[model samples]
Target: MLKPKRTAGSRDLAAIEMRRSLAQRIKELTEEPGEHLTPIPGLSLYHRTSPTPCFRASYEPGLSIFVQGRKRILLGGTEYLCDGWSFLLSSIDVPAQSQIIEASEKTPLLSIFLRLDMPMVREVLSRDDIPEGPPSAHRQGLVVGETTVGLLRAAMRMLELLDTPEDIPFLSPLAHREILYHILRTPQAGRLRAIATSGDLVQRTGRAISWLRENYAKPLHMEALASTARMGVSTLHHQFRALTGMSPLQYQKQLRLQTARLRMLMDGFNATTAAYEVGYESVSQFSREYSRFFGLPPIRDVKALKNVNTALESVV
Candidate 1:
């Protein structure tokens, strides 16, 4: 028997239905105009009513799917833009600047974020049924790709569990595994697989990254990091930059500045104290670098953030 060819109209209708279903599910989960954590572990919903300025934050390993509006994420000098039909994946921890580039009061920005579990990914990869591919050397850890129907459906099933909490314990894990399988079958799978596989250059770089994350407040020595990753100094530097989009020193500086900002905002620390707490030797250098990174000095930036929070609270 011969199968009939599918028409473009049918395909467009399918895509429209997928987007509509996902948008409805997300809106049900997100009741307000902010990030909302769902019952399913590692799954969260985000809703924004208007476009916002770029904000700096650490993006851990995860997958983000947008069902409405669009976003721009800046990693070093590269910018990744994604809309309702696309998604973003981060294979490792990265410091990034993200902005909501498109949104409105009526048609808000709606999205879902699920933190990737490396252990589960590794288990899935170990199965003999998984396809094998050659490892990539120069690929960055962050990638944006179009979302597939299978992946989107699996994600929607996972979100559906939020409405029926009793079913989550048994079915959520399976749905998550299916989602990972679909991701591993994408074109950007090589980088994600390398992050979990042993002895791969990307995995070795991840080890170094783990070390830096653990000891970001300490003085860094390239030799020590290279030894820990079991790579030559030159190779380590090359691979680290290839994966992270920044040199090791620059990466450390981002961590320090971000941490200092948090300390001032949450712990009520002064500029000098926050600098010292994050391993800054010279307060003057810290202030200069902080201003350059955040576009304002410590006191002014902190004050502005507090004022914004206060105004939002008053409105609420």
Candidate 2:
């Protein structure tokens, strides 16, 4: 069956304009070289220039829409590309690498990140009459969807709050809730549904993912995890791979490697100690895997990161 063409409503157009305005506001705020941390609580704006591959963790689940450049995020083995016209939504905290694919000194990658809140998501889901989805299947945690006017408008309204600090304390939550409501009702609702509706297989798989993130270095017992997620082992495996683009084990390995890298950078832990901390047993095995993943040995990679930090500090 063919899908019908989706149209943006008047409200959606308003959202686009609002995003443009917000982008302008962010640019104005950051006339100098530094990140502009928005005054709005739980929300932030990102502006990056120099083209390079940087790894980031989505600590807060939110929507990332770029107005100027493109970003490629590797979640598990699957890759998602989001540009000006598309939005990337990740509902879970998964370790990933995002590279700036397109950016220039003139037109940098301009983006607005709305920090998603569990209370707001649940509140919207409570009152809204969201459409019933097909029998739940494992849905990917991150997806690239065509932007809609309605979605954009809600974001714009939320951004407008930045200019009025007093309004934020009372109205910000309401605006954020409206955004979630719009998402729940849009065609992209499936992505929201896969995560929003709890206890379904996909939701269960999400729980499993949360567990892996916190217990990255620990042994992954599928049966035990499945039990915790209220799913069977077979079902858990299928859903976990489908949503994350990698099996549970692969996801765990990535987390371990990323954590070890951070340890080396911040605490000056050597390869052996860092490996042990992140659950690797043999020193040789840790170095081999670290090299394969990061393109350099632990010590070399740490040194390179330190140098880069120094250079950035000097410029700042």
Candidate 3:
């Protein structure tokens, strides 16, 4: 006997069920209200109860598949919302402000994040069968794309591998390839592709960005950065801004400030100590810039964060 033809409504219902199932899996894997690293390297699950204030955060090259809740992320100057209906992909490390805008005890935010392996992406892209995705019009480092059923299914397969750790070592790569292949086959693959392509301008600029991230505490030398990118100073500056929406100096500043903020908030570093630790020679100058960037001085900002944490802890 032949099966009955499925209607569009049935397809939509199936998709909804799959998302709910994925969300439940994430929630089960994360029994606490924090990040839970899985057996899969660089793959983690997150659960958050209640909305959160904006905080300084950095994105590694990764995929964020949000099965529930929503977040507001300001990357560079653009704002993106990551929710059950959308997936966020980052092609490189970037400093940004993010807030959990929709979450609660009754309906906590549950999601999966997988750090992208550039080498793996390149290998997958080299396959004879893989389609060359559409050329990107704007090559921003971070993009939010509407989720599709195929992508979800691939992600679900990866998540299931957690059930059999022994199988993961052999099977995880294949699953990772499928997830990446899904993205690469779409128009959204541009940044990931460009960065993975050897000697591509974006790839070179990505090297410069990585160097800046590693050495933000040291004095930035334009010549050294340009040399790392293997591009002229002017070209490096233009391309850096094109992909990251900031100059090299500006990116370094954000990285420095965010580092100092974390040190002060988490490591008991005072304002002057944090400032000098992050390569600021003058504490007063650091104070001025810190205030300008974070909307408050270091002491006040840290105090606010602690209080927020306390309130959240009490609720939890």
Give the lowest summed-lDDT range of ten residues in model 2: 1-10
Q: After superposing candidate 2, which stretches have Cα over 4 Å from the reference?
A: 1-20, 29-41, 49-52, 101-106, 117-138, 181-187, 198-200, 299-316
What lDDT is reached at residue 92 by model 2?
A: 66
Residue lDDT tens for model 1, 1-316: 1111344453376667888899987877777889998788899899987665566666788888888898888776677887877777887776677778787667888888999888898999899999997675536767787777777888888888887899988988898899898888776677668667634776777788888878999999999999999999999889888777888888888889988988898799999999999999999999999999999999999998788657645644
The sequence of per-residue lDDT tens digits that candidate 2 reaches over residues 144-252 is: 6656666677777877787788898899888888777766655566766555664467667767888888898898888889998898888888877776678888888
- How big is the positional error of residue 166 in model 3, measured in Å on the Cα after superposition? 3.2
Which 10 successive residues of model 3 have the least lDDT summed?
1-10
Best by TM-score: 3
Q: Count the backbone clashes (under 3 Å) in each candidate.
A: 0, 4, 0
Please rank every candidate by lDDT, starting with the best.
Answer: 3, 1, 2
- Model 3 steric clash total: 0
In model 2, the clashing pairs are 12-149, 12-150, 15-152, 15-153
Give all TM-scores, in the order shown: 0.77, 0.76, 0.85
| Better TM-score candidate (2, 3) | 3
Cα-lDDT of candidate 2: 0.72
